[model samples]
Target: MESTREPAAPIAELDEDAAQLAALGYDYDTTFKRDMTFWGNVALGFTYLSPVVAVYTMFSVSLGQAGPPMFWSLAIAGLGQFFVALVFGEIVSNYPVAGGVYPWSRRLWGRKWAWMNGWVYIVAMFATIASVSYGAGPFLGTLFDAEAGVNTTVVCALVMLALALFFNLSGTRILNTAAMVGLICELGGAVVVGAWLLITARQHDVSVLFDAFGAGDGKSYFIAFSAAALIGIFQYYGFEACGDVAEEIKNPGRQIPKAMRWTIYIGGFAAMFIAFALILAVPNYEAVVADFNAGSTNDPLTMVLISAFGPIGYKFVVAIVLISFLSCLISLQAAVSRLTYSMSRDGILPFSKKLVRVNERTGVPSTALILAAVVPASIILLSLLLPDALVTIISFSSVGIYIAFQMVVLAALRARILGWKPAGSFRLRGWAFPVNILALAWGIIGITAIAWPRTPEAPWYVNYIVLLTALGVLGVGALYMWLKKPYLVGSAPSGDATSQINTIAARPREQVSR
Candidate 1:
């Protein structure tokens, strides 16, 4: 007869004796690895492209109508994200885990509040996945313009979500591998394209960057650019993804915190450089604007490339754009799954047990992956049934994610200002704290600006959807608080170590019955 015993985990040991001693009948033993390197952490942080997102959102809206100082808006948003990253770094230093912001908020606040944070965090997370998929679908379809079919867009969205889910469920090793590859592709692609643009730019066109005079329309540059800044926030969202994997990170208390700091500066600067280079390299601002206004989904960057470097350069930009979208998709998947797992482990949602399950072979939160993919897939399918439904939902997603981000930053600031200091960790000395406080303020301002009604002519449905999504998130938080009351109020240790123990116990079991 074939052996019934499964192979043991190479990097971990089963604490069967201890389990027996405690009379616990948990399925799996304590077995996992967390040795991610500095570079790996960098890869994880860089996989979320601020520049691509910044460009996409900036061009999508009428930011130029408001003013030409759009870059300043990006600068403001980047600065805001930078401060939030510092606050996050402090928290990660002391209690690094995959939960990232929500868990940190919980630790600083309390279990009940953490569950509320998780409700908002997870809802907003899946909403983000839907938004990205929705946003990318239109762009990608535009790339295929004349031949783009409705069925094609739907199919592509589903496929991308499925593949992302596979990468997520394949476990930590595959996730890290994908992160490294995606990061290289994204960083290298940005640098190469930016370099090409700079090398070939005529000095006259480059002069446009340093002009102090605003585009001087009726709109103030700050407000118009603030619209663009909304897009800028996209680029930095994934940098903290490494923090989500903190428990799986080697020496996370030190390395994860350092990774967060490094990610903020590097990701922020790189994104700014890309934006500057692309703007400078564009030979024809009129052409770039015309293409964007014409709704060409080939990427505004591709339009810039074609205008500057001809057909070949345009093709190169096209490839880079696709890679950028792919990297964003990968980073989003990892973040959503890890967050779902974290929330589940805390019993903040339904299917808590299932969502927290780690596959024996993969050591991934498989059920969480399924949930992430399914939710987005359903949203996409619903889009098919309702023509402009996905668009509204995508917009709602931005509102949700931005609000959640604001809360996390505010919570971090509250902790710091209330005399909570990071213990034995990487403190951002030398104006970092002051900068962080400013960033928090800017974050709040930006979110409020984006949420505000920009035009009287703007559709009424947008207002309704945004309002409804906010209420829904809050409602879920209330529901979770009621259901998970015991877990939050039980006075158990609520940090990485305890969570890790629960995660270990939740794994698949293969015991020696004798």
Candidate 2:
């Protein structure tokens, strides 16, 4: 049968967009230009996740902890995060606000809860940018045949940060273009390298993937699996970047949710495929593990690449890896800046007025972009002071992001319990209850796995840094909120809860129509 439904008029769509923004306490004139298309949003999420980069960075660590069998944990983590993404999809479809969790939480719960969510998320994102840039150091060094020492790595990271900032400042068009190019390189590189290694140089037996090989401190296989799951947990999260830029996304209520889920689906497959190929291509898995245990150079993945593709091929692959890394940094900075801009627009953060100001020429949040680069660059300096700064920062980022994510999931569950129903096109319908519960449970497990002290023999600060940092962030955010309660409540547009809801409800029926 021929369809009779007519496409929504452009003016009607604009009115709907404006009404939705107003409901969230925003005006069209003050928000980001809705220039990000569906593919751009997908590219942003994919590049942020950066399967090839993430898998390469953490592959050796997972193998050292649980041998090749750790690949199974990636599958498990992907399943759990699938549900989490669904919950996030539903929220973004209805709200579709920038700042991802912060604004979502504010609408679901209250300002105080949203403030803390942003606090942890902002800290985690800064640490994430630092960690990702630092991880790129080795690959950059290999690509250029430079020494991958601490000073060299730090310098490389700074340079990458500068490039990311330049792209970010150039506006969404250039940034999205770079992201699309990165997506092609990332996926194409993964397929080429993975297929080459798997077909030409597989060294391990198929059954090796199920074998723990006694890697887990003489503990049970489950314990070893838990230890290895950290890589997957961290790798699966960059999909939320789609939501972080919701305001800039066209038809965000529908497209952003689909983009978020597709980010995970594609990213998870790419990560696993590359990891499996690398595992199969290892010439001497035992020696590689032993080198890792002995705290030797942390370039086992590079060695594997060299063995598989020879020197020239290795250099080419390293260049691809560098591209992935740079793209990841760019996506990270974009997400962080948007989040910062969203919070600032709500007058939650210090210097909100300045930070909320977008550059008219570039259509980018200039102050927020600068702040994003400065915070991560400053955090990167910790590499000079700490012996294991890279690992510490990675752990901090993983745990903090998981905590912030779980908070939103918990809020969703709370809203559901209070009879709050989602009106988004991507809603789970009756399935929301179970999905939210499962996602929350999975989040808690993921958080525990990341925070648990893997090595009791390590120094107190090293062993407990993730937990300590999380606590400290929460404490500081709570104190800030408490001290500035009056001002915070008065300054924000959404501060008047009753009026905000009433205003939204009073919007014209056509404007509020889905």
Candidate 3:
């Protein structure tokens, strides 16, 4: 008996998408399976941002630095990031290419700029994976009732990385399903936990949200507030996961932009709500701050959860956090692999041919996935070797990502000034100039804030590590470009529109699937 199944959908739509891409001078073949729908794309962004995971990871640091006032940073960062997202949406709608910033920069500016953008972005993404995995270590330790030491955290982080790689290599179907599951778990966990904490609140005064009780170490409240803003700055990123996987998304020009904006709006609200709930729930804010200042290994969030829900319930929340962490890792790895594959496909990176190869059976970028995993794992191992360097290394995650992002935003602004109008479904029209300028300004401030030396009292090396690391990464990337000149010069669209159209229309349809 022969089994009956509908024939796979014809490649007509895929071919059309390829044509649209070619019109923008991006003539690459569609190697990715367009299995991601609108919601799936949004899920990818949400899981990558992973508010619960981010808040859980940074709560102690932010609370210790700025007390309850740190929660307000979310609103500030969210507004700033919305401007950035607006620019990103316009660009991605016009150039819905894989490797979000890299390819977009290539079309808007030039190859050299795009190559450097990708270089910074790829490094930042690797750091993010390591940081997020290490962040999850405490929760994992809590769940297992294991000691939260350096060695244990390193091991846990490595395990998380390995699991994320497995899911990434499993192909888009499984990965998307896992992302959707993560989105549900993330939303449910935030709402349920937040509502519970709010209902049983210790009722700290509203003024507490503006008080910088922990501002000291020769740092004024303004500096402390800037430091606290790092929490929101870091949390608001990763929404570009939607744009990074644009090739895999259906109706990307229309859907990807919406997904990106929605990711920011929704993720921001969730992050703020959870932060507010946790801040209000703190039975004794000063005590938690003192514990953090005393270098306590226990997470401040753990104390709040224990107070609100007891040991068993706290464990349950830990489990949810673990899920959030795992999903975030998975999303990060997926986005990084696509970015790697995109750069490799354009011959911008070394070992381009090998890195661009996709597994025909699974439609996955196997080599890129492995590369993404190995680099971050090495970073993690490096941190283990020099445990004190962990903070400096992790600092690269947020700063690096923002730098790459702002680079693209700058490129888009330059293009707009030069009359490079968006040719997609989304456009800002009259509002483009002001929004782009604001986004650029905000990004500059953000990069400075994140890289600024928070602890002036500490050793000079420790204080300047973030700035030094960012400079070192860019310097190396610039050196690489100068030495190899791997940029694809003269790749921009030059021929007449009619001729280009004729060329694309004449190309064999089978080429779309190549």
Q: Residue by residue across 201-287, what tens digits does model 3's lDDT show?
A: 557867788766655445577787787777888889878889998878766877888998999977988898889899888877777
Angstrom error of the Cα, residue 30, model 2: value is 5.2
**Model 3: lDDT to the true structure:** 0.81
The order of the candidates by TM-score, greatest first, is 2, 3, 1
lDDT of 2 by residue, 196-243 (tens): 989887888788897666576555667767877878877888889999
Model 2, residue 168: distance off in Å is 0.4
For model 2, state the Cα shift of residue 427 in Å.
Answer: 0.8
- What's model 1's overall lDDT? 0.61
| Total clashes for model 1 | 5
lDDT over C-alpha atoms for residue 407 of model 1: 70
lDDT scores for all predictions? 0.61, 0.81, 0.81
lDDT value, residue 295 of candidate 3: 76
**By TM-score, who's the top model here?**
2
